[model samples]
Target: MKDTNKHQGLRNQLAKQLEEKGITDKNVLEAIKRIPRHLFLDSGFEDFAYQDKAFPIAAGQTISQPFTVAFQTQLLQVKKDDKILEIGTGSGYQTAVLVALGAKVYSVERQNELFKITSALLPKMGIRPKHLSFGDGYKGLPNYAPFDSIIVTAGAPIIPKPLMAQLKIGGRLVIPLGEGEQIMTMLIRKNETQFEKHEFGEFRFVPLLEDKN
Candidate 1:
């Protein structure tokens, strides 16, 4: 059985942080609360998993700060069992959160090491889904097109058109935009030829890169 106390404490901490930051989405807050953040990081840093800060993991990527995760996820407005395409699988933390929120997540990790580690870690955490892939996040998973939502974990110089095309009409895509420094961007497809874009705020994330693994 899972450790209820640790889970409760993490939930409380994340809830307080989200409230202080004005994250109003109850579903997002609860998703962050239920998932065990510690399980997503290196054992040495597990104690700090619930803190509102990023921590280094393999492949020179840092697990995103808790508040950022919650903020981006809140923007998605996920529904029960929605199919989600996650562009980056750093540490698999965000994927775990999506699964906890009842999403059927299909995650692609460009970093082979992270892909392997999380492939093993997620199942142990009871966050199993039918698909996990090691590939470039830019290409997306075309075979599973028309995802209910798409979340790009890394920063892109511009939104990749291919990834955008994968979204279902009325679907949401949350990605970090800009070249050097980045801003969290949300795009909702309005129709075959149109979308609505909103910029959140300045944020830091690893560059989205090409991969063939």
Candidate 2:
């Protein structure tokens, strides 16, 4: 819970690394720099927290690498107060980033441990997302349909049909699609029936499992 000047300097250095690697979104970079990543990780890994690598977290999930988080966020082009539905609340790191960008984040986590931990931790850090629900991420919070942006933090075999349907027209969905390895994919809803899709590159992530509660 203690964020010293050294920790802040490390975060700044990590932000610079992300910038050198082609992340040009200032807001996204700032969010990366602002969040105390070490606190989201187990205290044992605090020494390596700002190394730009994912570290294992509770519930068999790994905190996403900073570059990956920044890349997905840049694709989202988040606007302040825009509603965002985040799939996979593991470690609550990404959710904090979205909150820092001023999004009304609605996050879903299938693992109850992760959900409860993140639900409790976020508020302590003054990051109060619109809602944090414990349930299936694939379902995509239908009751709050039509999010301005949807980000899938896990690797899905295929895009969840419901999530596609849940996005507002012209809204964006950034997800990783595959099994052992994933292609970073982005979808922009064009109209009632069509979507424009593109693949950014490849990255590995924990699977977006089904029906785990």
Candidate 3:
């Protein structure tokens, strides 16, 4: 119980950071507050959990910063019961955030090692999303098309076209575009034939790869 209190303290710090950074979405802030960032990170680095910096997790990938996670979730405009597709599960931290926001999450991870860790952690965290898949996230999940929101954790040179097509009309997809250094971008599917683009800010993320493991 005392440890839970410490966890809550970290969460409060995260909330304060988000609020100071102008993250006004109450739901997004709430999700950030509720998800345990420390638990998702390596035990050795648990002290840095709320420090607003990406930390290396199991795979070559790193867990995204709190602001980046909150920023993307805010841009996606998730609603309760909305179907969300997340590319690059990583530590399953963002997946846990999506679940906290009350979205039915479908997350895909390309690295076998990271996928395995996340699959085991989600249940431990009590964040049971609708589905978790191990594969190339660039393909998205065809079987569960027309998602209300989509978020890609890694940086892709180009937004995967199939992912755009998978968005429902008026749905939003938030992704990072570029190599090495990237800019966080959002795409709103205005209709079946068109999308509106918005550039949020610059961010750095691991490359979105196609490797099986």
Candidate 4:
């Protein structure tokens, strides 16, 4: 699974397309360009990897579309070595982007199969997360609380209380909210009790399941 020149070309094109789609964060776009998405995908889907579309991965989850990953990452406003808690580790693609942006990523996944696969795969790609846990995303990583920012890759019905508690006073939590059609929601923690909520347009994601696999 070597990253070829052709793969790099496709990634470059995908980055440009993302920029045109209103993803203004240069670091996010560059990170998107740097990571080889096709490597994270199964061989059958490798040809379509750079097409900016979501495709099925193992464990009943889908690798997120490139634009959607960029959108979530851009909203997080990551800085160098920002401690980011990622709710899902599907395909490890989003984690790779965050790592490429110099983030200290702490990722969680519910599916045991996906978790096992990604935990091994990320290290092979040099995208090792600070901590990779198999547990509920809603619970977050309590021991490593006070994260600089948190990004939930699945559509949560409601923002989990534990996640809010784990964020630093000024941290941001990016998540998609709702059932059938989700609305991208960003929560900026203004204080211990006050959070500023901003809603982006609707996007669909698999439900964020709690305490179940």
Query: What TM-score, computed on C-alpha atoms, does each candidate reach?
Result: 0.94, 0.98, 0.96, 0.98
Candidate rank order under lDDT: 2, 4, 3, 1
In order, the Cα lDDT scores of the candidates are 0.88, 0.95, 0.89, 0.94
User: For residues 177-211, could you state the per-residue lDDT of candidate 1 as single tens digits?
Assistant: 98888999999999998999999889999899976
Query: lDDT by residue for model 4 over 90-207, one digit each (tens)?
Result: 8899999999999999999999999999999988887877889988888999999889999999998899999999999999999999998999999999998999999999998988
Clash-forming residue pairs, model 4:
none
Q: What are the per-residue Cα lDDT tens digits for candidate 3 across 35-97? A: 878888888887788888899998778999898998899888888999999999899989998
- Evaluation by TM-score, superior candidate among 1 and 2: 2
lDDT: which candidate is best?
A: 2
What candidate 4 gets wrong by more than 4 Å, as runs, is none
Regions of model 3 farther than 4 Å from truth: 1-3, 211-213
TM-score of 1: 0.94
Model 1 global lDDT (CA atoms, 0 to 1): 0.88
Model 4 TM-score (2 dp): 0.98
On TM-score, the stronger of 1 and 3 is 3
